[model samples]
Target: MAFALRSLLLLCGISGLLTGVWSDLKVVRVPSCPKGWSRLDDRCFLVVDKLQTFADAESSCQGLGANLASIRSAVEDEVVSALIARFASTGYVWIGYNDINVEGTFEWTDGSPSVFEDFDGAPPTNPGEDCVQTYPETLSTWDDVDCDTPSPFVCAKDLH
Candidate 1:
């Protein structure tokens, strides 16, 4: 009898947890993009009015109170793609991931590479290509490109 009671209690607890999670997810709406920016996963990225080099893009993100944004989930990636499509910039957008630490080894400026791994679907394996960017030319997710090539970047920060 005791074992059966425990099992029933466990089931109820699990059900409650699932219910709460569902409610939370439902309440979570996509964040709004700021003017001249795109919104994804509650974060906004700048839409360059004029084409700028990668460095310039990074600077722009900084100007907006965030660093170069990185997409770490399918949801965020989709948002980025949607924004990119809408804006239709010529090329890739700079993300926080890069191989600046070691050749062919990508890491985020945030210090933890794994934190940004979700956004990094397939990383670079080539020796020369170190930095990461979602190349506009291909829809294969992320592509390793030369760091100095210069492209637009995404920036992220705390909601509060």
Candidate 2:
């Protein structure tokens, strides 16, 4: 019957599509981070040796096709802190979050919403402290500091 034949052809086509999809998924590989960068989760991060103001640090990261590292989770915070410990000279490290545009409303440079925060002691209440940085005492915790303060910063690139 023609109807039976069409059904059989449809089933075969669906099976072929499934097989192709499975093969593609099986062959898909996560590319490694570039040399001198550390991989964590689905991103690559690097601690710049040079110290720069928060704005300059952001510019430097942009130059490398990355943005100042944004900590989205506790695991990411730990990883970035470890990277800073390994390569940073100064105690504090500039991150991507800032309340510059709106006081008390911190946002990442990449325009992502801030859902995770690990503040040290107390969050910045000082009017001049707008840029976020890792606390020296607790590397995982963050604090808002003056944006002009020069410090080494971490950069993050997404792994596509």
Candidate 3:
């Protein structure tokens, strides 16, 4: 009886191990972003070399099947800032935050709630400044600028 029980337990263990390995093998690998784009945290980002107005930048990104990059966390901000630092001619780059819908409340282009903000000097105090850009002096911080200001921008797309 003891020998049978031991054999049954071993068989169960082997079966479980095989099942785990099979599941792992079935997992699909995610492809990397296309050339000239960087992959970070399941998102692909591309920095536009040419400068454009905030609205124009957004439109350009849409044409590429992406939207203006949105920074939702400090780590994401750091990643984007590094990318911009490498490619951006101007210190600042346009992001996806804007207060066009409501004067004081900023929202991401994707319509998601704004949970993170890294304002450089002060928050967007002026009413006319509706668009947001990275502060070149402090790459990690942000500043609200006029939507018509021309600047290079980052475009982001999900990898999923």
Candidate 2 to truth, TM:
0.79
For each candidate, the alpha-carbon lDDT, in order, equals: 0.64, 0.88, 0.87
Give per-residue CA lDDT, model 1, range 1-160, as digits (tens): 9999999999999999999998887455645656676555456665553555556666776777776666666676666666666665665676667776677666665453454453345565767666667754566268767767766666665343
TM-score of 3: 0.79
Clashes of each: 8, 0, 0
Better of 1 and 3 by TM-score: 3
Per-residue lDDT tens digits of candidate 3, residues 1-160? 9999999999999999999998888667878897899998788999997989999999999998889988878888888888888998888999999988888788888665688889864567678899999864575778888899999999998886
Candidate 2 per-residue lDDT, tens place, 1-160, comes to 9999999999999999999998887555769888999999789999997989999999999998899988888888888888888888876799999999988888999776688889865566779999999864475778899999988999998988
If both were scored by lDDT, which would come out higher, candidate 1 or candidate 2?
Answer: 2
Clashing pairs in 3: none
**Residue pairs in candidate 2 whose N, alpha carbon or C atoms collide under 3 angstroms:** none
From the highest TM-score down, the ranking of the candidates is: 3, 2, 1
